[model samples]
Target: MRYALYFSPAETNPLTKAATQWLGRDAFTGETFPTPEADGLARDTIHELTADPRRYGFHATLKAPFELHPDQTEAQLVAAVERFAADTPAFDIPNVIVGQLGRFFALVPDTVYPDLQHFAARVVEEFESFRAPLSDADIARRKPETMSATHRANLDRWGYPYVMDEFRFHMTLTGQVPSEYAPAMREELDRRFSEFANAPLTIDGLALFIETERGAPFTVHRWLPLAPVSENRKIAS
Candidate 1:
């Protein structure tokens, strides 16, 4: 089993509901959904495009999946997360927009937000001790040869190429959309996520997601909300 630290809104949140419908699966409930209707896209095409994100569920990955370090226990990690959540103040990203990362798509902040970057960095650093080093197979899967020197170095050090300075926060919405499909996919995504895109997204909680085995759909193991700013300040004082 492997675990990932991710940011996901509560299951009942309207944003979550819309993303869940668009992606056709609920990471929190393990339920499958029919592909949402789109004017120019067939259900099969929509499902094909979403296959990758569907397995992972709807989330912005903070820490990529990793096995526990030999000396660490899951209970210890959970306790650490609880304590971390209790002390960190919640914040928000002012606007989110549908943006493509290479050929695939995701919801990204319209502008950089330092608090979001710092929060993500903190998660990576805070949980580093719990992450086992990447095995040769895992490293190979990341294809170090194609990575730039910095990304390769980061993969070597963090077990993920996109952490720290390399991280660009994104909640992946699809697998690679073929060049032919990109325009329509973008249009459909905009239509489907209009209520969420270009609106503030609260960074309220950390979700612990687990994969029971390779290729299995991941599911939320816990949803830990960050304490309010006032509460955190009081605790600190």
Candidate 2:
């Protein structure tokens, strides 16, 4: 079973209910309990992804999926995550939007936020000690021949191609929207998210997600609050 630590807003906030409805038992929707839409654009963007619940849903990835290291156990991984969460205080992400990134659709951060990206990188880096190096087959499957050298390098080092330089913080809403609906879909998403068209989105915590087998859906294992901690009060530093 592969496990990933994630950050899920639906688990804590009421504004994500509509998104949970759209996702049903897949992806982000299943892990997060039902909630209402925080912003109109969030509703529309999530709705489009849920249009095909079997495939898409809304949620951000803190740790990309990976198996436990040969010497590592699940309990150890969980403990590591807990420690990491404890050390890192929570922070907010400013206004998000339903934007088009190339040919795909996703909810993106409109502002240039270094903390969000840094947090993601920290997750991947901190937990790396617990991660097993990807097998050749795993690498092959994750990295296609069409991938560029830069992306391939990212894959070899980080186990994912779109990290660091290529990373754009987004919670994917759909795979590939059929061309015919592209225009109208974009319009609807834009109109719907207009309420939060520029509203700040707070990232208050972290979530742990699990997939036990090949055909299983991810479920939430833990939710850690990202709060401030006074360094001076540390037990040992």
Candidate 3:
């Protein structure tokens, strides 16, 4: 199995509910929702566009997926996640909006925030001990030749091309959307996620997601809030 660290709101968060409906899957429950109603868009097309993110579920990746190192154990990783969540305080991204990343649609910060950057970088650095080296197939799958020099270096050292300076925080909503469909998708996503558009998004928790095997859907293994346990909302593990 592979594991990923992500930033996901509590299961009850409005953003989580809306995104779950749009993607048609809840990472927390292993449940599938009906494809959200999108006027003028075919349900089949909506399904096709959202297929990728649905499999992964709703999350803003903090640390990309990795297998445990030979020297590490799942128990150790869980402990580390809990400690980190307890010690690190919660923060917010000033404003977020529906934006396109290359050909895909996602919720992205209006501007790069320093605190978010530092927090994401730390997650990468802190978990270095738990990440096994990338296998040849994994490396090839990242398409290093198409990446920038900096990205290639990061892939070589960190096992993920997007980390530290290369990270662009986004919660992916759909896969590659043809240029012709961009305008409609943007409008539809804006309607679906309007409450969060140009609004602050709290960085409240660190979620550990588990992928049972290659190509399997990921599910929430744990949701640990950044606040101390006694003060935070009751959340499931």
Candidate 4:
């Protein structure tokens, strides 16, 4: 199995519920939800648009998926994740918007937040020891030749092309939409996610997701909250 560190809101969070419904699958429950009707789009069209994101579920990736290092045990990795979550304090993104990334659509921050970047980078760096180096097959799958020199270098060193400076936090909502379908998809997304637009999104926790096989749907193994260490100290005192 391959493991990924992802930022997932609490299961009860409205955004989480809406996203899962939009994609027609719940990562937490491993259950399929019916796709909500969109006025201008056919149900099949919406399903096709969301096919990719549905497989991965609703979350922003922090540390891209990897097999654990030979020296590391899954138990150790889980403990490390729990420890990291307990020590880290939560923060919020001032605003989020439904935006298109190339042909795909996602929820993206309206502006770059330094704290968000720092947090993502920290996740990548702190977990490097637990990541097994990417296999040659994995490297080829990324199509490094099409990537820029810097991205190729990042893949070599970080095992994923987008990390550190290259990372742009996005919670993907759909796969590539044809140009003709893009406008309708955007409108539907805006209507469905309107409450979240310009709203503060709390970065409260991280989740561990596992894919049992190469093409299997990823499921949440655990969700850990980011409780401030100072809060624990205060309670103890």
lDDT at residue 5 of model 1 (Cα atoms): 97
lDDT of 3 by residue, 1-237 (tens): 999999998999999999999999999999998877787678899999999999998999989999999999999999999999999888789899999889999999998999899999999999999999999999999988999999999999899989999898999999999887788888899898999888999998999999999999999999999965344433531
Report the Cα RMSD per candidate: 2.3, 5.3, 4.2, 2.9
Alpha carbon deviation, residue 129, candidate 3 (Å): 0.5
Query: What is the overall TM-score of model 2 with all chains considered together?
Result: 0.79
- lDDT score of residue 210 within candidate 3: 94
Every candidate's lDDT: 0.92, 0.66, 0.92, 0.92
In the range 78-185, model 1's lDDT, one tens digit per residue, is 999999999988888988999998998999999778878899999999999999998999999888999999999889888899988878999999999999888899
Candidates in order, TM-scores: namely 0.96, 0.79, 0.95, 0.95
**Residue-level lDDT tens digits of model 2 in 106-217:** 6788866888889888887888887788888988787568799998888888787877757777765555666766776677656545655466777767777777774466
Model 4: per-residue lDDT, tens digit, 1-237? 999999999899999999999999999999998867887789988888888999998999999999999999999999999999998888888889999889989999998899899999999999999999999999999999999998999999999999999999999999999998888888998999999977889999989999999999999999999985476664764
In model 1, the runs with Cα more than 4 Å from the true position are 231-237
Please name the candidate that would achieve the greatest lDDT relative to the true structure. 4
Q: List runs of model 3 lying over 4 Å from the truth.
A: 228-237
Clashing pairs in model 2, backbone N/Cα/C closer than 3 A? 15-36, 15-37, 16-35, 16-36, 17-35, 17-36, 40-192, 41-192, 41-193, 90-226
